[model samples]
Target: AVALGVKFLDAQRKELPQGGAALADLVTLDMSGLDPRLGTVKIEVACDVQNLLCGPEGASAVYGPQKGANLEDISIMDSALNNFGEVLSRVANTNLLELVGGGAAGGLGAGLVGFLGAELRPGTQMILDITGADEKIKQADLVITGEGRTDFQTAYGKVPVGVAALAQKYSVPVLCISGDVEGSPDFLADLGVATCFSVAEGPTTLEEAFLKADEQLERAAWRILTVWKLAEECQLKKLRHS
Candidate 1:
């Protein structure tokens, strides 16, 4: 499935402004001229399922602020998303302006669905399916997964939780090693994680942590693996005695 980025697509639209590229300029576009090949393939997108194409809770208004957008920028970005959505909708003969999750990734979700015959799914699910994670998990004795940081947010369709779900299907233990860890260990355990470890050994600035990331990660992995080996040996001894 082709997941198009709204900003990237808008910047590429034939319409251009004098100062720079602007999404609002594309409002006058002809939808009938959209790519014809888009109809032939099934497109799926990954994003937050609750956001709409345009408005207060929409992509631009909600996410744009964090991207360094001032009030003026928010208005322009919102207008651009609306323009893109409307044009794509007209060309594809499908209305997606208020479609759920349409605002994800700056309205890319809506644009692809409206213009490219795409559907939307959780990003984790999409990645797992694409990577054949289920098949891979079934063959492994233990699964190790990590990210820059892990927290309760991990349970909300994040990578580690997604991997844990697959590993759990085969009753395999899952271990998470990350740059930083938040929430309680029990929280991760409830999500099917056997345990979690952080590369950060003590309080340190982000710059220091980044510089030592490689060394810290290698040391953390070695320690976990060593401990796991001992645990396995103990289990084996118990089984033999029983």
Candidate 2:
């Protein structure tokens, strides 16, 4: 009877049974007030896992190195991921070592696929589907989307790109706002983004910017609305004259 139960459990693991259940935990370290390079590397690794596995690598890299890992430590973690990828190929008969988004989360992506059978899909697509953003675009007067930063990466399946595409299908103008603008803003025009704005007034340190993010966003919002109001007034005046 015990042997039968054990066999049943193995079968369940091999094939997702009715009422599928996920048994796992994702751990991330709290890395704050530490070396920024290490922190960023850790975050990049975790993001890789999240993109490849279930949801994005939410916890690990985002929080890790802040807890005290240095560049050397990050490299060690990266190596671990490479080795894990090799192991995954042997066990799963799928080589995720070279997969895009595979290097996320210190190789957490490899770990997820190798150990938990997760698959990688574009994060933007997932968000669009989940939010019914396509339908929303059809109804909206204007589409507004934003991020902490806008750069070349924004073109790579980021929220703004996804939202802009949906807005374009409805022939609606899409606007983007970001805490900082990097690279060329004109580049995003091709993505159905009509315009982009950076919140910063001028040069400021990272600490000052973060502290002022909410206030800056509020001010930007007011400015945008004010411009829209002026445009509306001009249109109304023209109609009256005509």
The number of the candidate with the highest TM-score is 1
Estimate candidate 2's alpha-carbon lDDT, on a 0 to 1 scale: 0.60
Hey, what RMSD does candidate 2 come out at? 12.9
Please list the C-alpha lDDT of all candidates, in the order they appear. Answer: 0.75, 0.60
Candidate 2 TM-score over all chains jointly:
0.60
Best by lDDT: 1
lDDT per residue for candidate 2 within 48-88, as digits (tens), equals: 12233221232223323545766555444444444445544
TM-score of each: 0.64, 0.60
Question: Which 10 residues in a row give candidate 2 its minimum summed lDDT?
Answer: 20-29
Candidate 1 clashing pairs, residues 3+ apart or interchain: 43-118
Cα lDDT tens digits for candidate 1, 52-82: 8789878877778767988988887788778
Judge candidate 2 at residue 78 and give its lDDT. 44
